[model samples]
Structure formats: structure tokens, C-alpha cells
Target: MRDGTDHGDQMSDVKKGLLPGQLIWLWLTGVVIALDQITKHMVVARFDLYERLEVMPFFNLTLAYNPGAAFSFLADAGGWQRWFFTAIALGASVVILIWLARLTAAEKLQGVALALILGGALGNFYDRLVLGHVVDFLDFYWGNSHFPAFNIADTAITIGAGLILLDMFLGAGNGAEKKEARKKHD
Candidate 1:
């Protein structure tokens, strides 16, 4: 019961496929990368390597470099960890970029979230590789206790992870195949 005209039209649509949401996601990834780099550059230029500028009752702009992973894991490992971490990050970024290019337009939020994480990961990855450490600023404290200092890239990764978790829970119904599965499960 298929017509030649319908088949040709369907093929043409596939060839020209792209939704607005996809464009937004791509743009979001770029924005996160640019913001992360710009802020890091500002922090590096304005602040001495490890100088602190007390800003408020419980916050400061302190320049510090992390030699290891979160909370400075293996930071005192005599510096071998830096190269290892950088290699891991570079590998992960490569995989993520490839994934982003292959994603369809309808999977906007998911793609965007992934892109943000990827960008942030690469941003830190670059620092860790080139500087042998990741920069830390934006210090917060509760009396003597302090939360770890972090940057915009870290924020983007955290937010992206949260959005991805939300998307999975809310059933975004991004693609025809996914929608069918969701409907079946529901």
C-alpha cells in the first residue's frame, strides 16, 4: 500500500532533518565552554597564583591549583597523577564529541547536557594537562570550615548531570523509537 511519492518525500525529509532544539543544544555547549575559559582567564590574570581576596562574610576569591581529582585526591602523589588524569580526560572528551556529532536534533536537552559535561571536562582536562593542575577559585566557608573552590566548568557539568537525570525520570520521548518504548513501559 506504499506510494512512490510518499517514499520520495520521506527520504527528502530525512536528508534535510534537523529540529530547532538541536541548534539550541549545540549553542549551549559552546556557551558553557566560552564562559568557563573566560572566567578562568580572568581569575588567572587578576589574582596572584595563590593570593586570596576576601569578598564577603563567608566567601573569597582565592587562587589555588588542584593537582589531583576532586578534593585533591592523590594530590600528594609526587605529581605522577597529573598526566594520568589528563590522558583520561582527553580520551573521554574525544568520545563525547563523537557522540554529540551523531545525535539527532530532537534529543536537545540530552545532547546539550552531554555537551556541557564534555566541554567542562575538556576545559579542566586542558588545564590539568598543560598546567599540571586544575585551577580553583570562588572559595566559600562556614567559620573555619570550607567548601571546595570550583569554577564555571564544574557548575556546567553538575547542572548537565542533573538535567540528564531529570530527563530520564520525566521521559522526554525524544525519538520515535524511544517514544514507543516509553509508551509500552507506561
Candidate 2:
């Protein structure tokens, strides 16, 4: 006994409170948050602001702070950026959680990507909320040019973004295209 209506009902139930979909990936989010905080705390404890310890020819552990977005985009914007960025992170986190809960089982890659981004957003959100700035310690550079110092949260966010791009090209998008082709044939 099968009915087409049952699938729609199941989807509605999942969308409602009756089912928790793909939230299994939340453990990854927690792990990313924990690691991000721990590393930031360690950098704060071991290094003075602007102090640098050479770890390699092109890499160093440098204590730095950013009160702005990536690359210190608004580091000197008269301090409103902190609250603004924090608000964005909070909103993004909420949206990511809802998106995670609504994901289908087949969207495992998307689930992981969203979880990493959520974790990174919250990790930085904690800093902006409590410290008013993010602690950055990992630095890379060439002979005279130094890249912006960043942290575990930034790294996770970057990797998550890359995964999202990869999925767009190789994952569900392709499956949808295949499904569309099948529909055309039928």
C-alpha cells in the first residue's frame, strides 16, 4: 500500500518539529568551535600583542587582533563594526541551523559544509560578543609582504566555503541536472 501523498507528508513533518534531519553533522560544528576557542586562548596566553615567533621561513605565530571583518576591512571604522559583525554572525548561525535541520539525507556534503560555516561563525561571534575583537595568531608572508594573520575560525570558514563551491559544481547540482534530463526523456 503506497501513496504519493505520504512522501509529501513526510517532508512536511521533517520541515515541522516532528523530525530532525541531517542535524547529525552538528557534532562537527561543536568540534570546530572547541578547537577554534582553544587555539585562540593558547595564542592569547603565550604571546604578547604583536609579538612574533618564527616557526618557518614563511610562517610565524604572531599575536594580532582584528576588530573588523576579513583582512581587517573596518579595523578603524570607529568601533561600530564589532556589533555589526556580531549581528551578522548571529543571524548566519540561526539560518545555518535551520538549513541544517531541513537538509535531506542525500545532502551530506552540504550538511557538513553548513556545519563548518556555522561553527566558524559562532566561534568568531563569541569573540566579538565578549572580547570586541578576534584574536589572530597564524601568519604567513613573503620577503616583505605579510598576509593578514588569521585563526582556526577563519580557516574553517574558508574551507567550508570551498566545500560549498565544490558541491555546487560536483554534487547536488549535477544530480538535479540529471533528474531534469530524465524528465525530458520521459
Candidate 3:
């Protein structure tokens, strides 16, 4: 109804793969994956492992491989962690897809957030499945202290997580307002 369309029409579009439902947000997911993979490929071709090209006072285009989770967690835990993370990413992608498909049209923010997270997860999952590690290139540092290197996928995931938190807080406020309005009506 947001666009003068009914839920039946939305469902028809979904069935036709026209991407008119909340699944329309999957277009963002595809864009993120394409950008993430393209950038990672460019970095891999242009730099050697651990190579750093300073771009600014606090940023660099560096080449890094992470065999573990965020911040290189379990990076040194032999080789099993690679598959473990891959499996998790695969499972999460499936769950996100289903969740995105089930979202009401009103849940636009949540849909976008889930799509971003799904795209990021699949992008990293591809690297883990094929390369045994995730390629990370963007680096940020302050003087001698450097943050962990990450890639476009990580950026998307982080942004998506922030959006979800925002939606949660906003939804809470709206719910409270609705409750107050109901009390006044009663």
C-alpha cells in the first residue's frame, strides 16, 4: 500500500522474481558482493601479502589474509577454523535469506540490514571456501597503533549491524508510543 500496491501484487512480483517485495533489497546484497569481490581481486593483483601503501595519515591500502574470524580470532588454531567459519557463514546466509523473504513490507529498514549482512557473509564465505582465507586490504592506523585490516564485506556487515540496532531502538520507541495512545483511547 505504500506505493498504491497491494500485498497480493507484491507476492505475485516475488513469485515472478521481479524483486518487488522486501526481497528487492537483495539487489543491494548483489551490489555489495560484486563490489567486495572486485575490490578484493584488484587488491590481490596489485599488492603482495602484507604490503602496505599509505593513502593518508591514518589509512592505507594493505594486503592481508585472515584465516579466522574478526580481528584474526582463532587465526592460529591450526586449520579447522577455516571450515568452521565457512560453515557458519553459509548457515547465516541461508537464515538471512529466509528472514529477508519473510519480512513485512513495512520492515524496510530491517530488510536492508539483513540484505547487507547476507551479502557480506556470502562474500567472505566465498573467500573462505575457495582461498582458505579472507582477503583484507583496507587498513586504518593512528600513529603506531593500527586497527585490524578489513575489506568491503566487513564494512557492509558493520553498517548493517548498526542499522539493525537503530531499527531496534526506533521500533521500541514506536511501540511505547502506540501503547500510550492505546491507554489514552481506552
Candidate 3 shows a clash count of: 0
| Poorest stretch of ten by lDDT in candidate 1 | 13-22
Question: Backbone clashes per model, in order?
Answer: 0, 0, 0
Q: Give the least accurate 10-residue stretch of model 2, judged by summed lDDT.
A: 9-18
Checking candidate 2 for backbone clashes, the offending pairs are: none
Per-residue alpha-carbon lDDT of candidate 3 for residues 34-129, written as tens digits (9 for 90 to 100) = 999999999999999999998999999999999999999999999999999999999998778756665666677888898899899999999999
lDDT of 3: 0.87
> How high is the lDDT of residue 50 in model 1?
70
Residue 78 of model 3: what lDDT? 100
Scored by lDDT, the top model is 3
lDDT (0 to 1) per candidate = 0.75, 0.84, 0.87
